[model samples]
Target: MKIMEYMKERFQNLEFIPSIYNQWGIGIHFCLGENIYQLKEKEELNLKRFQVVYEQITIIFNELFEQNDDIFLVTNMYKHKKEKCIRKLKVYQPFLKCKNQKCKNHLNQILVKTYPYPFEINKAEEYEMQQFSLLCKPRDLRVTELLKAASNEDFPLKPKFGGYSTDYPDVFFVNITKDNIFFIYDDRGCEVIALDFKRIRHLYEKYHDWVEEYKCM
Candidate 1:
């Protein structure tokens, strides 16, 4: 099945819907015909369903990276594992086509099911490990820059702190925030990428700030 179809099927099975709303009773938001964000205000079966949806999306993301080389993935390893570590993940397809039809050479490469993380994160570490595949995930570049700039000294925020994980595989998602954001980690506990929430929110805010900035200009 196409990856999108797989995700939609998974999403449909979860039966997730918006249960929470703002004070003004707004419960859902969309961008580019996608349900980019939602809030949950009530405790219902759908809450569990939402969690399932999130996990499925994480799995699908990993599959996409492993299947297509055209896509780029990066993640913040240190943020998730702590220490002065970071990781840049790349996905590769298993087979390459031969240019010569007469040669009949079908070269095959090892399909990397999982990218080994330096750390030793396992099911014993957290319940999340049980439900999702933690190895061989995808990441993006923002996390790479964060790793380059961060200090190597171990601090209290080391393990039980803000690490990295993005919601999607190909897209950028970093977990270096004080707020609660979504994340997916490698088997050894590495963030795939720092997410682009700041950009999203900045764009939202820009709509309001444009008038003031325009006046100053």
Candidate 2:
């Protein structure tokens, strides 16, 4: 079956749910090359347009996952202007500090001395400490390493700042696990959703002709 047909079947089966809040409605944003298109509930959701957007997204994800096992899909939200609806999908790598043993040990000592009781630092403070550490040693270090040394996994490090933008509400993070795929949406109202990836994967498998076309060009 074609990808749009497959997606339509899934929609009929109620496999996916639309994102709808009291004031704000849910929509799908597409990033194709430099152009962006949106299928929003407020503007009347177009199934065909949504299918096309999702097909493009699936192709991008399949290509990316082929190169790397893990990645993030970032979508930028816009409220009033369709022209400003810019969606960006890219690879996300968590910041890691030092991989070396000696540097790791040195950074651990610094954390022990500075924040003995497990404290939190803002981005500015974190940067300052990173600079201080770099000046103090021959060993290379990273801010993430220092963060890991100071905090336990259960109580991991978190950013001090809050989400920005009233116009652009949320950012999505997609990841593939061994058994399933999942996504997390971070938003201003703390509106978050975690969903399975099967529906999307099915769409990708159904319509992958664009992949061959791109490869040829």
TM-score of 2: 0.22
Cα lDDT of model 1 overall?
0.24
Quote each prediction's TM-score: 0.19, 0.22
What are the Cα lDDT values of the candidates?
0.24, 0.26
Model 1 regions lying over 4 Å from their true place? 1-48, 51-66, 77-82, 86-217
lDDT digits (tens) for residues 1-217 of candidate 1: 2222332432223211111111111111211102222233662222333333334334323422433223212222222322332222121111112244411221122111223332355632321110111111223122322221221112221112132342112222211221112223211111211123342343235333221111110
The 10-residue segment of model 1 with minimum total lDDT is 15-24
| lDDT, model 2 | 0.26
lDDT of 1 at 81: 24
